[model samples]
Target: MLSDRRLFLLTLGSASLASLAACASGPQRVERPMNGDFPGIPFADWTDQEPEYLLYPGDEIEVATPTASELTRTVRIGPDGRIALPLIGSVMAADRTLPQLQQVVSAAYAPQLVRPTVEVTLRQAGPIRVWVDGEVRTPGVFEMIGDLDAYQAVIQAGGFAPTSRQDSVALIRRGPGGSRMMRVVDLRPRRGEVVPLRRGDIIFVPRSTLGELAAFFTQVRAALPIGFSYSINGSNGSGFAQF
Candidate 1:
């Protein structure tokens, strides 16, 4: 089985494609459509006027919960996409939207609760980390926040170096069809290109595209022992050596 750190690094190593796509796709801006009483986030932050927040696989939501007589009492769904409600058992709550989930839950309780004023709230926001690796001056991790663009990620990594890969700055992201890796608008400084990056993304700045895969592996190997040593020593400095 793969270790957690390896899994995390692998996820980071692979997602550079999304970063590339974001740059290549270019930044798009537009207005958000209205959905009944629900509010809409402006499109000024999206690419091609896409949804403000790209929904992912394991997003968490919690309802403020209605009164005992108002709902099926207290039915909540776990992060694993399973829910053991007052009546309904585990049901897939994967891609369904908030409104869609509310409707589904309420519908099930129609025979019990009245009208069911449902409210969907994000209980545990999914992982929204951005990873920056290779050649960059300060390659590491970044938190994905409001309107984070690809340019922003590179900048956060303490900017590129003189011997920087420049053109091969790869940004990887995940979507419906597994994952797509592409070369985005060339990272020529001051080109006014580069798209906004997303959560669970990995941006790689290599010396050149020709040997980046090898470079990444080399970097990982060198990093592993140090990282492991640091963690072990950190948990218990002198005690670690005693074991």
Candidate 2:
């Protein structure tokens, strides 16, 4: 039978070996909505699956018909979210997918022709509008062209100011339930650290807490006393008579 001390040493050695094996396996990648610290906040990845691209105002689309070339044309969604195609006249295009709009256009032209085939392709995406506020060189609403990350978005907004915090950034997103949630992004610029920005997303860069503490300490140091001196005066006896 094994003694108690021997059993204890054996267990400790096994634990150490397991820990070393875990380290050799390399660090695990962190997925968003991180554990205890960042609860309820979800960070979106740059290579996430393509979301349902809804048609919005100012979006340009190309419509084509295999059977009828005359019916094909490129059109833009108006401010009222409607597009004027060749034969379909004015059709609602907002809040619709490309496939959905193609079906609508095909059905509209079906009455006028023996056979109508329609295809809709998004030629140009609408302004991917996002707001960059707090600690940036230029803080305002910006219309980004292509895929943008928080770091790239801040650069587009004129980069970070001197006081801007580069450690972490805040991203505000409106959830499907209409409630707003904020995620904290690490701005170390490591591989796989680029977080994709969505339309209506808000990026806020704050001042560093360590910077504030340093400033406070500087002020305190300036106000502190450099040096001090003290002197005591004593008089003996009376004038000079008693000793």
Candidate 3:
């Protein structure tokens, strides 16, 4: 009998092969109408304000206390998204902006010190990485360099496999408040469109066109290996789902 892991892999492989075989029957089609515009993100949501940099694990940050020089120290954020300090102990630091973290550390040390002034500075940033899987020649986590879009990241993973459903690719990103947001992007050639990707983003190329965004999420979660957890919270009218 195949081990559980082996059995799961075999099942996933069969599903992928079936999807590819379906694609071979005809040209891939977009199941949902795009209405001549990209779905998910809205134009009004675009803003000129630059997004604040959030701290991540493996990032080295210098926490300075001018009043209490002895308590000042530089520490790298741990995998648990925390940093240990003299008086405050372990403080959650990941996913917080520099100013936000400074406030948090200062508040934690307030009772111990007369007037606590904490300054958090990014000494070194952690490696920016993204996950590319499904129908890609090489599917794995890759360190991102400079600006990259979903299509560019796929190219970094040795482009799409022959059986990849190029017209429908899934981009999963971390949404506000730790929610997972998924968007289906069209990566066909000459589309003159790009879906910008951020650190820790997941780019999944499916073997067949994704019909309904909700159902596709379910299929993807099951088809992927263990550890890829997904839950659909709800969907926006424009093919976006929060998981």
Candidate 4:
């Protein structure tokens, strides 16, 4: 007995409800090749080529001058990535290997003392930290007690949220020459792949599969909670962004 227009409206409402129900049940898994031009390496193909020990801001080191014992002192690398010495003043210390720093210090003090030999030893290393964000129950920075992979770090952040796209998580890291490097990692169960995390690595779990790396950065900046700052520059064509 219903009118034709009323019948059509009823059918449309029923279809919308059905669609919502399907979405509530679970996400449909789609298997597709990642974008070839995406500016990130595949997690499976990534290799860790970091130096043995790169100095950080909080690292404490012993600068010993055997030739001039009085000049020997222990100092911590300041937040500005420099250490203040007796005669040479502030010298850049962070990112330099022990031997490289030793040579720099020796050269700096060459004019002040004869045979200005300097031995730099790491007295204490700084805390290792990583940032885990997006679609995780608890998103924040965490200290790495030991070796942890991308998956394990997410677990520490209270695991992935229900809407997380576990099949395609983004891992951003600092590459050579301070450039940004990103990798797509699969954290689905039984995948049996391990993407080892390095200090300052960022594990971002997208709510859905990302089509473009540049777009992903914009989404990250928006989703990040207060007290966190992230920015991207898409205009310059450099594709470099700060996180």
Candidate 5:
């Protein structure tokens, strides 16, 4: 983490008046309401499966030979909703249907691998990384995978108490021109009534604007001291650990 004072200094140095105004005025793009009480997207039109047309990066997945019980499984998926297979490398797997991906994988491995058995499954689907960055009991990043709506996303971020303003949660997405804002979700517990998450989605549960200021101060109080650290990579087979 960058030091708070340094971060603030950097922000001040880099940002122009117009940029600050833009960031302060509001996030770009439209704002939709989270609750379905307003009534939209007539259930009939909503499909149970994601679109097989496009795949973005950051798709967490697991592939293995189910034919044998000795699970020879391997996995790979970045935070952007993509899958990496043996010969095919990384293919957009977020939106593609299973059958469609299966065919693609089979064809890719046909020449080099003999009877190359492969299966593509989304261990965690969706590219929406819900960043709970403000006042909450527990705050961090939650990978918005399959069936993870606002409520579930918040729960994974460790839920909220009475202090939480359910209606204040906002979803941030990057668009063609700039960062777009989509619907402020009112965190509520509901089973299977959430929208299907797409790749590159960023849901931020911000408190009220003043609440935002308080959050900033809270962060300031925590960073009285500064520090840094690093770790070495690479495991040499047998018992990879430091004593």
Candidate 6:
């Protein structure tokens, strides 16, 4: 009978062998759709046209009430995505368009005033961040605004590197259902490419075809075994050999 330690090792080795057998067919790459526009982004009305900039953390805005000038003051959205107002206390501002925030402010003050005329204007835009990784000059998180598009974001990251596959850049976005969706966007220069990037998006520029082949060879080299052997000897030390 094998010692407890040897038995445990034997069980682990058996499981690993089974897993390897199941994967004998090798990795099957999923063929994703490649297109000019990014999926999940609303782009029908997208142009060089400016988006209805949503309020986010670090944004500065002035809320003006025609009747109540005292309530009209410039305030910065806190990191918590909320703003403190004298009457309304703390109001959630993140992810809300200017008009939507105006409505929220007005409703909050409805009990105080018969009709509160609330006008919200962006005093100054603030730092908005997105992750730009893979095959760019600088692959990291970057700060940008609402109008920033995928092209511009890549440029800000020091543009594409020589190893980049410009035709198939992946834009990973988190859907409202809390699931992530990936869309391979064609970044070839063209006239009036109007796709816009959003906050917290990940822009991954895949490696060129040549680089992909090199990666596959590296994987093969790492996985290929030159020699191996394992056996159990009766009463003698456990038999295991490798070369």
What are the lDDT scores of the predictions, listed in order? Answer: 0.50, 0.60, 0.66, 0.66, 0.45, 0.61
Candidate 5 minimal-lDDT segment of 10 residues:
37-46
Cα RMSD, each candidate: 12.5, 25.9, 10.2, 14.5, 12.2, 18.4
Off by over 4 Å in 2: 1-47, 56-58, 110-116, 125-129, 134-137, 143-148, 159-168, 172-182, 188-193, 196-201, 206-243
lDDT by residue for model 3 over 130-235, one digit each (tens)? 8787788988777778988888888898998887877767565555534444445688877825877787777777765434334444655664454421111124
Model 6 ranges off by over 4 Å: 1-50, 134-138, 144-166, 172-183, 186-201, 207-243
- Give the per-residue lDDT of model 6 (tens digit) for 136-201: 998766777548888888899899898776655656554442233445566766732445887656
State which candidate, 1 or 5, has the greater TM-score.
1
Query: Tens digit of lDDT per residue, candidate 4, span 1-243?
Result: 322222222222322333344457776542322323232322122335663567776789999999999999999887657899999999989878899899999999999998999999999987687878778999977878988988899999999998786776766665553444445567987773588888877776766432333444444454444232122223553322232
Of the pair 4 and 6, which is ahead by TM-score?
4
Model 4, which residues run further than 4 Å from truth?
Answer: 1-36, 39-45, 174-181, 190-192, 209-243
Return the TM-score for each candidate structure. Answer: 0.46, 0.48, 0.64, 0.64, 0.37, 0.51
Clashing pairs in 2: none
Residue 57 in candidate 1 has what lDDT? Answer: 35
Candidate 6 clash pair list: none
The deviation in Å at residue 75 for candidate 6 is: 0.3
Cα displacement (Å) at residue 66, model 2: 3.7
Runs of candidate 1 exceeding 4 Å displacement: 1-49, 52-61, 64-96, 103-118, 122-129, 144-147, 161-163, 174-183, 192-194, 199-201, 215-243
lDDT, candidate 1, at 135: 70
